[model samples]
Target chain A: MEDVTTLTKIQLDALREVGNIGSGNAASALAQFLNRKIDMAVPTATILDFKDIPTILGGPSTLVMGIFLKVLGEISGRFLLLIPAQTSIKLLRTLIPGCEIDDPLNMGEMESSCMREVGNILAGAFLNALSALTQTPMLNSLPSMTYDMAGAMIDNVIAEMTAVSDKVLMIETSFIESEEDLKIHIFLLPEPKSLMLLLHKIGVN
Target chain B: MSVVIPVGMGELKVARSPETLVVYGIGSCIIVSLYDTKSKVGGIAHIMLPDSSGIAKERLNPNKFADTAIPALYDAIKGESGVFKANLHAKIIGGSEMFPPTEDYENNIGRDNTAAVKIALKKMGFPLIAEDTGGKRGRSIEFVLESGLIMLSILGEEPREL
Candidate 1:
């Protein structure tokens, strides 16, 4: 189940469909909150070697802002929202007036909670779409926020995740805020067994 | 000028004098650095899991698990320099708990990894010299064989040698 090669074209397409709907909903949610337009690139679901993951968000040393959530319930996995450092600062300033962007490394309670709230909203929308589409029940843990090197922020999850399966099914979606093209990447990594169950639920199995 | 070799996840590498080993962006993963001071030779491993027990063997790279990677790394370093056992010493780094403890399945993999690396090193008879671990930050490290010094770099903090 960890091997993407075992997944047929139909199954992959179905997974992509999941990403599309999920991200599409998430994008609209953000757009409404910001009172503007947001665009999402075509979502992709790919099976990746654990090593290549760091390169996905620039590199292992690339510093960024990350919000993590553990999906809870029958179809369980992990959810991640990654925003590049500069973009995170800009978004934070926009959300909370007078919020400091000068130091991307330091964040007060207000800033951290703001980011966490946004994370819950976006992740909520995405998961809600998945639940509706598959008629499955699931929820997410309270959001945890951190700013650090991309590999450091993510490798731990990959370690815990890949222990069972060497491969990861990354359903990724990129949100582009049409005006400035601020980009945010959302990733949903399904546990091995959960992925199989998801495919079956979506009629792909 | 020494050439630096980068060790990625689940990878193990050995080098001689003037060569350095680096592991980038380690969180919850443990970096085990072993050096033979006499020969100025070194080995590094980026171990992702505590051990390989109960994990399926198919496609399992032994180098990623602490229990397996330590012995294999020691052997490789020993073969590289033909150094005797006494000269080898170990320094470990990067076991930051990325998230606070959650459900047991999502508990502190970083803590588990650090403990596992310690047990493996002890059983193999390598003297543990120094260590920097257990925080809530990500780190990148470079190991210099010539001096057996490790330059530990954390995001938004000053780099220190261990």
Candidate 2:
């Protein structure tokens, strides 16, 4: 019912702050899991209408392994973890020692589930941060992994979002391990109602 | 060389000959393509949702839903280029699973969109010709007006015609 495209500068800053804290937690968890130092860029937000939503997280058609987790309960939305095809090999190796996916496109079930596990850890950490801050109980669905064009991987998610809201608020944080040429993008998209509730909880309303 | 135009989600594009209309990275969303053989009036719509039933009227875009996009694309093609409805053949592409069937089985928006688009086209009396739908792969399609071919390309796969 509210217009997200018209979010004020303060709202934008609040959203960025939310992304920053959540991603910070996820980044630390990833670093600890991988036993390496991972540098994360400051989180940023991309709020756009459905007409422009498909073009982000890289051009729509860029080959990617999209890992998704549905956030449920007190606050709801989706968490999309995008690991580009080029990063999957290195990422898998780090996530699961000696278990790297040679061909991301033709991944086996084991390989796919491994990616989902990665999604679980990252999204869990991010959601934990929100839950802790808000003192609300929230749960995430089982992680789902798909290998496809970025546009294709995300269209259905966008479709569901559009059924209720005109715009999508994507809070993106990039984890860069430059030495390994490994970078992952985590996008947090909260439903509009949940977003309002979240902002209210964070004292930005 | 002919110009290539990119169509984004919840939008539609119509152009004449020597031009191509492309919608990139179609997953779970459906792309409705309409082209006239004689007039070379080509159009492509990247529709996100199946319908706009409960959507608010003020912010609604006709091109965002299959139920509305089909008629809008038809009217746009005719209005912009004066092509007859009978001259336009319809092709549908891109209705991919966002998750494996094992996961989000009940809520495959891609499947719903494909079905919705088909129903809308049938209701509008458009002759449906070709389609590429329902798979795990995402597609990027190019609708070339010069030849009226929908070049549908998926990752790790060769481009194919719809």
Candidate 3:
């Protein structure tokens, strides 16, 4: 059994570098779509244990949109983008300038559509970066949205990944531009039987 | 007058007035709504986790988790200027998987939360009036104060009243 604690460090550096590249691409995409200057900062990367997710993100509450993807033939994972409710509303208003939404509690169809598009752009950029780094083809699943009670969200992801792979690697990144704060969490879970194959391909084992 | 009692995770709110009680973003958590038409009173609780024992000692705020929150909800509704027993009605929504690939933790939390709620409600002598639970989606629930109608919106699903 590999030490899960230490295992994250080995890939942490590489994931951070990838995040830098991915953020740049995503910023460009958003800027082009919104027709405005979108300033984004490359976030410091960290590895979060399943237990610490809630505290790391602020509270035991989260709103997430995730997309699953199969990459490098042997590795399968998901790209998750998260924002707190306050930040989501702020970002949405910015993205949809001149739209007046009175109730912050109400999420109308237009807001949902905008969020979905944002999900698509972020997922596309992140996956493209992964493909380039690994020199592998990637296939994507439709994006889905959810709000979770903090730690439960990460716990669910770990539990689900364990069924397919004994170990799961999580890469964490954040985005902040002006007043918007967005966090992106990525996971790479290789099926148990395919673990060795992936390790060999990455020259890790 | 409409009194909007916002039930945060693991918290419950009850009002005697004909006011709407709402709980937002009930993702994997469960929202329990009880109403008494005769008394013209209603309440809602949003429970986050299945058990309070597993939570930190400081988080014992009944409004933050399922196990602790349900009991608090009962006390709030039944203890004070609450409703008469004969006029009470109940409904529940939200308790969804939300995440598919992570069936163990993500999916099970919703189920566990619902079970805990049912057990608590049964023990409290409150029968379920209606329920919309279980799926791979999140929901927002509102309990109409005057009519005691529960309105829910689930992702990709039509908005409905129970």
How do the residues A1-205 of candidate 1 rate in per-residue lDDT, one tens digit apiece? 6555578778889999999999999999999988879989999999888889998889999988889988888899999999987778878888987776666678888888898898999999999999998899989998888888889877777787777666788999999898886889999998877788899998888
* Residue-wise C-alpha lDDT for candidate 2, range B3-44, written one tens digit per residue: 989888888889988998888788888898888898888898
Best by lDDT: 1
Report the lDDT tens digits of candidate 3 across residue range A1-205.
2323344454555545656676677766766765656666554555444334445556443444443333334455555666556656665777897866643346677876677677777767766765666666665555555544444354434433332122345555555554344434444443334434434444554
Stretches off by above 4 angstroms in model 3 are A1-39, A42-65, A68-79, A82-205, B1-3, B56-59, B102-107
Encode model 1's per-residue lDDT on B29-59: one tens digit a residue. Answer: 9999988888898999999999799877777
Clashing residue pairs, candidate 1?
A: none
RMSD for all candidates, in order, please. Answer: 1.4, 2.1, 9.2
Q: Residue B98's C-alpha lDDT in candidate 1?
A: 74
Weakest ten-residue segment in model 3 chain A by summed lDDT? A158-167
Q: What is the interface RMSD of each candidate, in Å?
A: 1.6, 1.9, 8.4
Off by over 4 Å in 1: A2-4, B102-105
Off by over 4 Å in 2: A164-166, B80-82, B101-106
TM-score of 3: 0.53
Ranking by TM-score: 1, 2, 3
Q: TM-scores across all candidates?
A: 0.97, 0.93, 0.53
Best by DockQ: 1
Docking class of 2: medium
In terms of TM-score, which candidate is strongest? 1
Local distance difference test values of all predictions, in order:
0.88, 0.82, 0.60
